[model samples]
Every structure is written in structure tokens, then in C-alpha cells.
Target: MRPEDVSALALLLPGVVEAAHQGHPDFRIGGRIFATLWVEEERVVLKLTPGDQEHLLAEAPDLFAPVPGAWGRRGWTNLDLWDADEAVLRDALLAAWRNVAPAALDGD
Candidate 1:
């Protein structure tokens, strides 16, 4: 999916907010970012669950890759839009919520 589509889908989550600071799109809950749309890079960086993260990278390293810099070793993954679509993109947002939101709110 395109960045704008991801931005729209992100808004469907509860307590989610969008902010444009430092010239990039940030989707947050409780003032913390769950996903980000890098305008310059045309990429969507999402925070995924630890177990889910490992599974995706190990199973489909080509479709998803680790985010550079901070959080690389944590639960962040990057999706290249060349082969991306809304269904896969929406699942990425769900994964982002699992990483950024609290376990109490995630329903275990």
C-alpha cells in the first residue's frame, strides 16, 4: 500500500494519533510512535512483535527487512512497497500495535 493508505489505516486504531514533526509522518498511541511513514524514503517503518518479527524475517527476509539504526535489534521491520499491498500493509500495522502498545491493552 501507499504511504497515505497506511496513514489512513493507522487512524482506525484506538488512541492512535498522527503528527508531522521533523517532516515525517508519525502514528502514535499514548504519545509513542507505533508506525512511521518516511516521506523522503517512501518507506513505512513498523514496530512488530518479537516472536512475530523473528518469524517474518526468518521466513520471508526478502519481503521484510530490519530497520536501520536504533530498534534494529528490537522489533522494527521495513516493507518495500514494490511488492506491498493493503492487506499485507494492514497486517504490518497490527504488528506495529503489538510492539508499541501495552500488553494490558493488547488483550494478551
Candidate 2:
């Protein structure tokens, strides 16, 4: 998948909005960023739980990794788009979106 593909998937989530953050495109739900497109890096970053980040990293190191520094410590992850699988990407996006999406939006 590419950055556009990631952006498109993120926009599909309910209440998701596209905005710029520090010059990069960020996807948010209720104003909380869930994903970002790091254009120069050619990577898509997702807001996941630390546990999920570890799991995904271990499961697919070639496609997923921690974003680095404080943000990463707080569950931010970078996905290598060129090696990412569509199904995995969709699942990852949903998980990230759900992390910030209101409970009602998630049917909870």
C-alpha cells in the first residue's frame, strides 16, 4: 500500500478528519490523531497500544516498527507501506482509529 491508500482507509473511519500537523498529513477522530503520513519517509504511522505495537513488530518486523523516541514509547508505530499487506493494513488502521474514536462511534 501507499500513503494515499493509507489516507483513504483512515478517511473511511467514522468521524475521521484530515488535517496537517507539523507539515505532514494527519488523520484524526474527534481531534485526536490516529494516523499520519510521513511523506519523506514513505511510511504510515499509526497510534496503537504499546502491547499491540510489540505484537505487530514481532509478527512482522519487515512491515511494522516503533516510530522512535517518546511518541513511539506512547505507542506510535511506523508501517513500511511498500511491504504492508492490505488486510493487515486495514486491521491496523481500524485498531488505531478505535483507540481515539468515541465509544459510541465504535458501537460500544
Candidate 3:
């Protein structure tokens, strides 16, 4: 999927807002960042739980990878936008959104 596609899909989630972070576009829920777009690099950073990060890394290493260093070990992942499948990206976005969205807005 493309960067715009990723942005569009991310905004479809509940309470999601687009904002700038570190000179990059970021998606937030309940004011907490869940994803960041590194457009120039053709990658998106996702904040996921360590378990989810591990599963995705093992399952789709080509499309998803750790961000590097301590942040990566703490569940920050990098998604290769050009290689990402729309459906898989959508699922990952949802997982990331849910990771930081407040419980009341989680649609439990």
C-alpha cells in the first residue's frame, strides 16, 4: 500500500487523529501515538506489544521488522510500506491503535 493509503486506513480507526511528530506524520488515539509515517523512507513505525511484534516479525519479516535498538526490543516495529499488503496493514494498524487507545474507546 501507499503512504496515503496507510494514512487513510489509519484515520478510519476510532478517535484517530493525524499530527506531526519528529517532522513525520503520526497517527494517534486518545492523544497517544500508535503509528508514525516516515514517508521519505517508505516505512511506517508502529507501536505494538512485544508479543505482537514478535509474531509479525516472524510471520512477515519482509514487510515488518523491528525499528532497531532498545525501542525495537520494546515493541516498536517498522512496516515497509511498499511491500505491505492492504489487509495485513489494516490488521496491524488496528492492533497498534488498540495498544494505546484508552480502554473506554477500545470498543470492548
TM-score for each candidate, following the candidate numbering: 0.83, 0.94, 0.96
Q: List the residue pairs that clash in candidate 1.
A: none
Cα distance off (Å), candidate 1, residue 65: 0.8
Displacement of residue 96 (Cα, Å) in model 3 is 0.5
- Prediction 2 global C-alpha lDDT: 0.89
All candidates' lDDT scores?
Answer: 0.78, 0.89, 0.93
lDDT of 1 by residue, 38-83 (tens): 8666678778866777887786677788877668678788877557
Order of candidates by lDDT, top first? 3, 2, 1
What shift in Å separates residue 25 of candidate 2 from its native position after superposition?
0.7
Question: In lDDT terms, which candidate is top?
Answer: 3
lDDT tens digits, residue span 15-37, model 2: 99999888999999888999989
Superposed model 1: Cα runs more than 4 Å off: 103-105
Runs of candidate 3 exceeding 4 Å displacement: none
Which scores higher on lDDT, 1 or 3? 3
Between candidates 1 and 2, name the one with more favorable TM-score.
2
Candidate 2 regions with alpha-carbon error over 4 angstroms: none
lDDT-better candidate, 2 vs 3: 3
